[model samples]
Target: MSIVLSDQDKSTLRAAAYGAVSLMAAATGSPQKAATNAAIALRSATGLVGHVLAANAKDIELKGKTVAELADRVLPALTAAMKLLGEQAPAEAGNFHGTILLAIEAAQIHPDKANAIAAEMARKITAALDAGVAPAAAAAGPDRPELQKAIEEIVDSGFVGVSLRVHDERGEWVGSAGTAELGGAAKPPTNGHHRIGSNTKTFTATLVLQLVAEGRFGLDDPVVKHLPEFGLDERITVRMLLQHTSGVFNFTGEVYEDGTIAPGIPIPYGTTGQEWLDNRFKTYRPQELVELALAKPARFEPGTGWSYSNTNYVLARLLIEKVTGCSYAEEMQRLILGPLGLSGTVVPDASPELPEPHAHAYYRHGDTTVDVTRQNPSWTSTGGDMISTTQDLHTFISALLGGKLLPAPLLTEMCTPHPTGIPNMDYGLGVFVVTTDGGGTVISHNGAAVGHAALMYSTPDGRKTLTAALNCVDDANLTIGAAFQNAQQRLVNEVFGGGQADPA
Candidate 1:
C-alpha cells in the first residue's frame, strides 16, 4: 500500500520540490555559486529519495556542463545524500536498491550526471570484463567464489569499508564491501583512489634502487656521507634506512613496551581537527622531520635492533633530493610513475586536492567531526603521502617482480629478509617476507595511515601477484586492525596458493 502524505506534508514537499528546481535554475546563472548553493540545500535534505530528486534537479539545471563541472556539482550532492541514507536506513539495510535506483535514475535523466556515473561504473565493469578476456586474467580474477567470500568476511568482521585487487592463477579480481562511510549505502569504490600509507616506502625504495642501478649511489654507502648535516651515525647505511634497521627514531612518536610516548612531529591522530585541517597544506622538509627525530635519542644505536620508523624513509627522501637535485616528487615521476605508466599514482606535494572521481574520507574527533578527504598530504610528507589505485598498485608490483624496475641482483638483495621474530613475517628492504602455511612465500609490504592502507605482493619471479588499496576509519588503538591483516592474508592464500614462494 502507498503511504499517504498528510495535506500539510504534501504542501511542504511541493513547495520544497519547486524551490529545489528553481534554485537549480537560478544557480545556473552563476554556475559556480548555483552549484554551491545546490550542494548545501541537497545536503540539508534527508533520505536517498530526496537526494535522488535533488541530484536530478541539479543535473537538469546544469545541462551542457562538462563532465568535470557536473562532477563538481553532483559529487557534493551524492556525498551528502549517501551520508543521510546511511544514517537513516536500518543497520541491516539489505540489497541497497534505493541507492542503486537513485544512481541509475540520475544517469538516465542528465547527460552530465550520466557521464560522471558511467565513468565510475566503467572502472568497475571493465575490471570485471578484463578478468574474462585476458588469458592471464583467469588466475586471480574477481569471479572466484573464495575471493568473494573473503571480501564478505572482511565486511562482516567490522570494517567500515574495504576494496581488494588480486592477480594470481585466475587473473585479476577487484571487490569491495561495506559503505564508503559509517552511514552510507553506496559501496566504497572497488577501484577508487586512496592514500597508500607506508607502502610509499616501497616506491621510495624502488626509486633509490633505480638510482643505484644507474650508479648514483651504492647500497652500503653511509647516509651521513650524503647528508652529514643531520649527524647520522656513520654506521647508518642506505640499506639500513631502506630495511628499517637504521635505528632512527620514528619522527611520528613511538610507543614502547611500557606504553610511553616519545614525541616527534604533530601527527593528525594527536591534534585537534581544526589544527590538522589548518596545517594540512603546509610543506614539511625531510630534513626537518629527520632533525626532529635526531633531537630525540636514537631508538637504539645504529643497527642494534629493528623498529618501524617513518623518519628512515623521510631521510631516504632527502637523500633522493640531495643527490638528484630534484624534488622527491619529480624523481618519482621520472623514475617510477612515468616509466611504469602509473597514471593513477600521485605525489601530492603541498596540494590538498585529489584528482576527479574519488570517494570522500573523513575523520571523527568528538561531537564535531571534519571532512578531511581533500587535505594536502604534506603533513605525512614522504613517509605515507602518495595516492594510488589498486590497479596501478597491481601493475607496479607485477612490474617490479617481473624485472621491469630493479635488476636481478638488486631485486634479490631487496627481498633478503632480516627476521623480526614474528612468525611467517620478516622485513626485507622495503617489503615483507610472508610465509604461507602451505609453504609458499609471498613478498609484500603493507601500510596504513588514518584512512587508507596499501598491500603489494609478488611471487619470487613476479609472475603472480596481488595488490590492493583499503580505506577505513583508522583509530589509534587499532581496534579493527587485526581483522584487516587477517583478511589480507586470506586473500593472498586464496590467489597464490599456500606454499608458492617468490622465484626471484
Candidate 2:
C-alpha cells in the first residue's frame, strides 16, 4: 500500500517543499513576518509529505517542474526572504500541496502571484498519473482499462478523490483519480489514510468472532449475559448484533420503510447541518451512546426484522472492552492490526487526527464547502470512525479471507449472508455477501463518515481484492449519494464483475 522513496526523491521533495513555501511568501510582497510564517507552515507540510511518501506512496512525483528546483537554483531572493523571516516552522503537517494551499488560502498573496502559484501547482502531480496505464505494464497485474475507466468515471461524477488497490491472479494494481485536496491538481495520495466509516464493523466483527474462536463466548450467547447493564432483550444474541438484525434504534438516526427517517441522537445527523458539525468535537461514552439508542423506541422486535443500526457496534465495542478488560483500541492492535502488519490503520478512540498524508475532506454548507477533515469521532465510535489506507485495508481483508485472522468456520460464519436492511443485498455477520454480475460472490463492506469514505471487497478465496478510499464534498442532504453509489458500482463491476451484487 506504500511506495518506498529513494534518497533522491527525498531531496527532491524537501527542496521542492522549501521552494513552495518561499513562492507563497514572495507572492505576499515579501513581508518579513509573512515570510517567517510561511516558512513554518511550508516545512511542516513538506516534512509530513516526505515521511508519507517514503512510508506509503513512492510513485507520487511532483510532476512537470520537479518542483521548485528552478526556484532554488536561480532565486537568491528566496533565501533572502527566508533570512528576513525567522525560522519557526513546525516539523510536519498533513500533506505537501495541501499544507501550502491552506497557507495561501489564508494569506495575503497577490491575485497574480496566487494564479502563478496555482499554475505551478496545476502542473504538479505524482508522475505517470495523467497517462493511460498500459495493460502490459505487468507490475501490479495487467493494467485493466475496465478498472482504470471505472475510477475515471467516478471522479468525473464529482467525488473529489479515490485511491484503489487490487490483488488478482495476475498480480496487483494500484490507481487513483480526482484531487487530493479541492482546487489542487495532485491526485489523492494512493496510500493516504482516511476514515473507514462502518467498515469498522467488519474489523470489530472480526475481533468478536476471534473471541468466539478463542472460546471466550458463543455467537448465539445472549447479550444480557455479557454486559447485563444495558438490559438488552435476552433474545438479542451476539450474532444478531453483528448481523444487524437486533432491531435496536440507531443512535445516529435511521430511515424507515415509509421513507421516513426517525432521528436519534442528532446523529449521522438527521438535523440541521451546522448543528451536527457543531457537536462533532463532543465525546460520549459508549454506554451513553447505547443508552441514548436504548431510550429511543426499538425499530422492531429483536431478531424479528432487519435494520442497520450504528448502536450495535458501539455495544460490540463495549462487549470487546468488557470481555478483554482493555480498550477496543488496545485489543484491535493485539488481535488484528499487529498480526496482519496493517501499519496504515488506527482505531482512533475519540482522536480527530488523521495521520500525515491524507486528502482533505469537505462538507457542503449551503452554497459553500467547509473543510471537515478533523473532528472528534466519538460520534462515529466503533461503527465508523476508524482510519486506514488502501494498503492496510487490502492486507486486513485479504488476511481475513485467507483465514489468517480466524478459524475457518468463523470466517465462514462471517461471510454467510442473511437477507435484511436493503433490497437485493444480504448481510453477513459483519461483511456483505454481494452477488456480482457474474453470479459470483465478493465478500465486501464499505462505509462513509461525512466527507471521506472507503471501499473494500474480496473473492471468497481472498486471491482477489479491491480496497479504496475517497474524499469528497459532502452535505447533510447526502448531495453526492447517488453519484457516489454509481461510482462505487462502476468500480465494483470493473474490478469484481459485479452484477446483481452492490456494495454495502
Candidate 3:
C-alpha cells in the first residue's frame, strides 16, 4: 500500500538529516564544532557534486544560501550520486542502500507511508553528502590512467573481473575492470576478498620463521625432527620444505620436466580436473592430503632440486600444529592477520564460502560456465586455501619486508633464492626472487586456486607494493596462462622499470 508524508514528518526528517550531515562532516576532521563544520561542508558538497547539481538543477537562481535550504536543494543531487556509485560498484550498492535506509530509522517518523518518504529523502541526502568526502582525500586519490589501462588490459584478455591495488610513492591507487559476475557490467570491488591460492604458502612460511625465531626450531632442522609421526625423510630439512627443496610430491599433482604427470589429489587444474570439480566440497585433513603425496614418488632427492609442491606446505601446516599444539588458523591470526589488523582475511578450513562483496569465480565444466566461487579448499590446505583482499595482502607483504614481522637476518635469509632450472627465476623460502629487465630484483609470490587468483608483489625494501585479485573462467587446461603471464610482465614493467610505467 502506498502512503504519503505530512508537513510535520518532513520537518522531523529535515532535522535528522541536518544532524547526520553535521555529525558525518565532523568525522572527516571537525569534531568540537559541528555547526561550523556543517557550514563549511555544505559549501564543499555543492562544489564536489556540482555536476550532479548542474544536471538536476532547474531555473533556480544560484546564490549564497542557509544550510537547511542548501540541504533541501541538494537532495536530488545526493540521490543521483548514490545511483552513480551503485552503478559503478554493484557489489557495494546494497550496503549503500542499507546505510541510507538506516539513516531514517533514527527519525522515528510515524506511519509507514511517512517513513517511506523520509527514508527515500534520507537516502538521497546521505548519498549526496557522502559524495562530498574531503578535498585532501580527493587530492590524494590515485587515478593514473596508465595503471587503469593495465587492469583494463587484463580484463580485456578474457578474465571476468580484476581488482587491483597498488601502494607506491605515487600513493595508493586502486582500480577494477570487467563484470563482478559473468553477463553483468558492475566492476569488482577493489577491496573485495578472493582465493589467495599459493599465497597462503607465504603466510605459512612466515609462521614457520616466526616459530623459529621463538626458538621452536631451526630452519636447518630436519622435518622428521618435529613431525616424526609422518615419517618424512631425514634429509628433508625445515628449510627444504619452505624452499621447495624437500623433493616431496605436490599433493595437487606435479608435472615433470619432460611433461609427464604424477597424480596425487583430484584437485582443480590437474589431470583429474573433472574429478576435482565433482568433489570440490569434500573435506580432507592436511595429513590426508600429505599422505596422498607420500604415496607417490618423490620428485628429487632432498636439497637437490626444487619443485612447487603443495604437500610441502601441508606438512608445514601439520608441523605448525604439532609444534605449537594449535591449529594453523589460530596461529596465523595470532602472529600475522590479527597483529596487522587484517580483519578481512580468513583462514578458512573446510569452508566453501567467500566473504560477501566478492566477485564470483567461474569455471568451464564442459559446455556450461560453472560458478566455482565456493568450494571446500581443504584439498589445497596450507598450500593454497586462504582468502584475503588486496589491502590485506599489501599490509602483510609491506609488514613482512619492512622488518615488522621478522628480524633483519632472517628476512635476508628468507629472501635468499635458489635457481629453479627456469633461467633467471629463483625460489626463496615461500617467495620468488626474480631478476627483471628493469635492472632490479622483485620479491613476489602469486597463486591461483580453482577459478580465482591473487597477485602480490613488493620491493625488497617494501617501499612499494602491488596486490590484486581476479575472477575468471578457469579449467584444467589453464586456458588463460598466456594472458595471466602477460598481465604479470606488463604490470611489473609498469611498476618498476625506473619510471617506465607506460600505459601502452
Candidate 4:
C-alpha cells in the first residue's frame, strides 16, 4: 500500500509507541531498568513500523502526573495510530501491533510474568491495540491530481525530473514528474537521495550551534582558538561563520553586486565545465579549499559585512573537528543524524557515490552530455556535499523548528535575520528568512550541485514543509537558473502561505 503519514500522524505514532514502554516501566516500579530494556527492543524493530518508531524521540511528548493519567492519553493514541495505519497500510498496522507487544514484554522487570501490576498494564496495552477503530474517513487534504499538476508544470519548465514531498494540514502529499534519466521513461524516485547542495550549510550550522549549546565553544569566540593552523582573522568568530558575516571569499567563485564574476575552481559551465568534468572524480581536502579562499583578498573585514561564502561553512566544519576531536561526518551522526534516525542523509567526505535507486544527474559540456551523479562532493565539503531524501529533510526541519533539536534561545538566534541586500529575504545562521510577497515568513535553504539540486523550506513553527529533488542538464552558464528559482517560488506558494521573488 502507498502510505503518506502526516506529521501529526507520525507524532501520534511516536507518542503511542514510546508511551507504551513508559507505561510498562512505570508499572514495574523500576522505571530506569525497565525503560532501558524496552528501548533496546524498540530499537531492534524492523520494517516500516521500525522506521516510524525510531525517529527522533524529541518530538514525542507524554504529559501526565501519574501512570493512570499517562494511560488516558497513550491508550487513545495507540488506538488512533492503529486506525490511521490500518486505513493506509494494513501490513504496517500488524507490524506496529507486534513491535509494541515485544517491547512491553521485554520491559517487564520480571519477564516470566511474576509481576501482577506489570502484567495488568500489559493487558491494558493489548486491549488498546486490539480495540476496533471506526472506519477511517477519506483523508482530508488537496486531491492528488492537483499536487500532480503542480509538479508537471515544473517539468514542463525544463527540468529533466522532479520529486517533491509536502506536509501540511492536508497531511502529506508526494508526487514526481519528468524522467529519472534524460532518455529513460521512469520518473524520479519520490524518496530518492540527491546532493543537497548548500542546504548542507543548514546542517553544518546546526552542528556548530549544538556544540555551542554544550559549552564546547562560544559563538563570539575567534575561529583562531580552535583552528589555529589556518591563521584565520582574529575578528572571525564562530557566529560570523554560521551567519555568513565573516566576509571570507567564496571558494566556488564570487559574484560581485555589479554583475562581475571572479573565478574559483573550474566547474561545469561554458568551456571551464570541460575541465571540471575531466576532474569530477578528483578530491580536495577541506584544508585545501579553505587555503584557496584565504589566498583571495577578504571579501570585507570580518563582521563588517555579509556575504554568502561556502568558505565559512568549510571553516565551521574544521572547527567542529578541532573541538570535538571527531571528523565532521562522525560529529554529524552523533549530534544530529543518529538522534533523528536520518538513515538516508550522507555527509560524503571525498566519496563519489550517490547510493542506489537515485535519478541520474547529467551535465552538458559543449555538445557532450555526461552523467555526473557520482562526482567527488568533497569539492564542496559541508558547504553543499551532503546527500538526503525529501522525507529526511521534512523530519529534520520539522524537528528543528518545532524546538526538538536546539534549546529555545539558540533556535531564536539561528532564525533571527540579517540584511543580505536581497529584496524581501534575509540571511539567518545557515538559512534564509524570507518574507513572502503575501507577507508570510519561512525558514529556507536551497542548493544546486551540477546536475542535481534539492529544496528545503518550512514555516516558522515547522508545522508545514516542502522538500524536493531535481535532476537536469546543467552547464557552466547555469542556463536553467531562472527556471530553478521559479520552481522554488511556485512550490513555496503552493505549499506555504506565500511566495518569494527573485533574489535580485
Report the number of the highest-lDDT candidate: 4
Candidate 3 Cα misplacement greater than 4 A, ranges:
1-143, 498-504
Error of 2 at 69 (Å): 24
In TM-score terms, candidate 4 sits at: 0.76
Model 4 has an lDDT value of 0.82
Would you list the C-alpha lDDT of every candidate in the order shown?
0.63, 0.70, 0.70, 0.82
Q: What lDDT is obtained when candidate 2 is compared to the true structure?
A: 0.70
lDDT of 3 at 6: 35
Residue by residue across 63-179, what tens digits does model 1's lDDT show?
A: 335545544444333333323323332110111211222222222223223344344543432232233222322222434667667777777876667777655553345566777
Over 161-275, each residue of candidate 2 has an lDDT whose tens digit, in order, gives 8877776764455677899998999888766789999899999999999999988899999989999998999999999999999989998887777999777665433465778
Candidate 3 pairs with clashing backbones: 78-128
- Tens digit of lDDT per residue, candidate 3, span 186-218? 788766779999889999999999999999999
Which residue runs of candidate 1 sit more than 4 Å off their true CA positions?
1-142, 270-282, 497-504
Residue 316 accuracy (lDDT) in model 4: 97
The better candidate by lDDT, 3 or 4, is: 4
